[model samples]
Target chain A: SQELEQSPQSLIVQEGKNLTINCTSSKTLYGLYWYKQKYGEGLIFLMMLQKGGEEKSHEKITAKLDEKKQQSSLHITASQPSHAGIYLCGAGRGGGADGLTFGKGTHLIIQP
Target chain B: GAGVSQSPSNKVTEKGKDVELRCDPISGHTALYWYRQSLGQGLEFLIYFQGNSAPDKSGLPSDRFSAERTGGSVSTLTIQRTQQEDSAVYLCASSLWAQGEQYFGPGTRLTVT
Candidate 1:
């Protein structure tokens, strides 16, 4: 079984500041996904990274997969209150039918 | 187009009772998944259903947990003789294909008291 460890289990940042959340996997990642969840709600898909050294950005958020494929990071630029939530990283096996292995998630608190 | 949808947004049942959670995937999606998220914890994989193949129940916590997908569209997860540990949010997700990005539903919050 693969395990994912996320750093800084909880973080408090000022609005408009930058912050990064890291996810390290115990095995090589075939597919890495980032999702955001509001308190007591379902997850919202953020981005997916497959290949090593892959980086994808949407608006103020960017996600990168390291060349080793065992580590990934989510960076937020000029964060807002909307970015305050739980960010989870999930890893999937190469096989199409396998379920994802998720990290404990990082709780982000954006102070206005 | 609608994403995944789940029934009984919130359910409260006795500890020894059985409960069923229903999930309706997006139209034309061939892959559906069930995950459990307990309070102060991460999401745990429960099962996976792709097309017509047998479901992957490898992630089920125990024999008391079982799920079935009917007509390759709607899925129902049944927990028998639920315990307090069974309290959590059951989320349903669907992807166009097995390896595609998954879209999640609002989830069913089950409280076993």
Candidate 2:
């Protein structure tokens, strides 16, 4: 029952390598957000994008939303060991009943 | 206080037994949500509560699954007549408003034997 599909379910990279994860939805997106969760821990809010084609950045990570509003991508530059975790993209319909509709998530592993 | 917290990080129960999971949201957070994550699957919406008003129970998978939020703060999810299919990680999240950034708890891993 997941409307969003994340590609490359798992990624393994060298410590300093760069990588990208993609999230595509079957429905038009109103609000898109990213979260990261370490094993056995709670999810940490990463970023939120409202407008289509908008881009946001935090540290070495940059996120971009598609103009069609049905897709988004999270890019990690110079990935670090601390960046290893499960990255999840969630979409909301943007209304009174809006709650996060999450993807299966992409697990990233950074090796030194 | 500082973040959303869930009680009993892990719970083990036998089939036909009942179980309850608790979630405490950050003060002043108006929106609370419950979700279930099956092993190797995406999170499925369970319920949504805002303030003291009626909650959105559209996501309840079965009659045995129910939840209540008291005074717009603490909430509990009750599972009755538990089955093996009920085993999953139950997660709780709270936000100041709908579609806003949500704060999640550690989640309770429920195992039914």
Candidate 3:
């Protein structure tokens, strides 16, 4: 089973709308990375959160990690067409692992 | 190179044949990773190599899959006795250190018949 679980597998919203995506983990998240992927391209790193109750923002996007370290949420304000892509959340196994555990992902589409 | 480069941008192979995929990471990077994305599915970890130490192969799906780093710079992923289920987009990423953020490549699309 996936260690990281993402909610709302797919979402469609109109341009300029506000949206939020959630990621939950069975184990505490040592590192949380949010990436956006344009169709057929490599992942474009958005932000990384390490400490519990951490928050980071990039342009119109903001992400927050809960104090328990088991969940995180990404919020997008005044969305744009360029923001349409697959959003992925990945969690570390608290270090000493080969790689990060990635969630299935949330596919978001912004309509004009 | 400026970013990780993967070759044979696309590959089409037959079942039971062996296939090799190559990756060249950004210069001076010490950590490398291999992942596979299967037909709209999330990326799956395959192997990880850090510095000159032995690679961590725990994520390999089966014995049919193996990877090697020649000089802590370039790496190759080989799949033997390929099955149709092995088709996917193979991605490579490199980080400056063992626990740093990673930069990914464009990926190689593999199609097995």
For residues A1-112, write the lDDT of model 3, one tens digit per residue.
Answer: 3388898889999999999999999987777889888888888789889888899999999999984848999999999999999999987655468577788889999999
Tens digits of lDDT, candidate 2, A1-112: 3388898899999999999999998887877889999987778999999899899999999999994848999999999999999999998733445577888999999989
Q: TM-score (0 to 1) of chain B, per candidate?
A: 0.98, 0.96, 0.96
Those runs of model 2 whose alpha carbons end farther than 4 Å from true positions after fitting are A93-96
What's the lDDT for candidate 1?
A: 0.93
Report the lDDT tens digits of candidate 1 across residue range A52-83: 99999999999999947589999999999999
Tens-digit lDDT track of model 1 for B1-113: 98899999999999999999999999999999999998666699999999999999988999999999999999999999999999999999999988788889999999999
Where's the lowest-lDDT run of ten residues in candidate 2 chain A?
Answer: A92-101
- Compute the TM-score of each model's chain A versus the native chain A and list the values: 0.95, 0.93, 0.93
* Better structure of 2 and 3 per DockQ: 2
Mark the 10 consecutive residues where model 1 chain A has the least summed lDDT: A92-101
DockQ for every prediction shown: 0.81, 0.80, 0.69
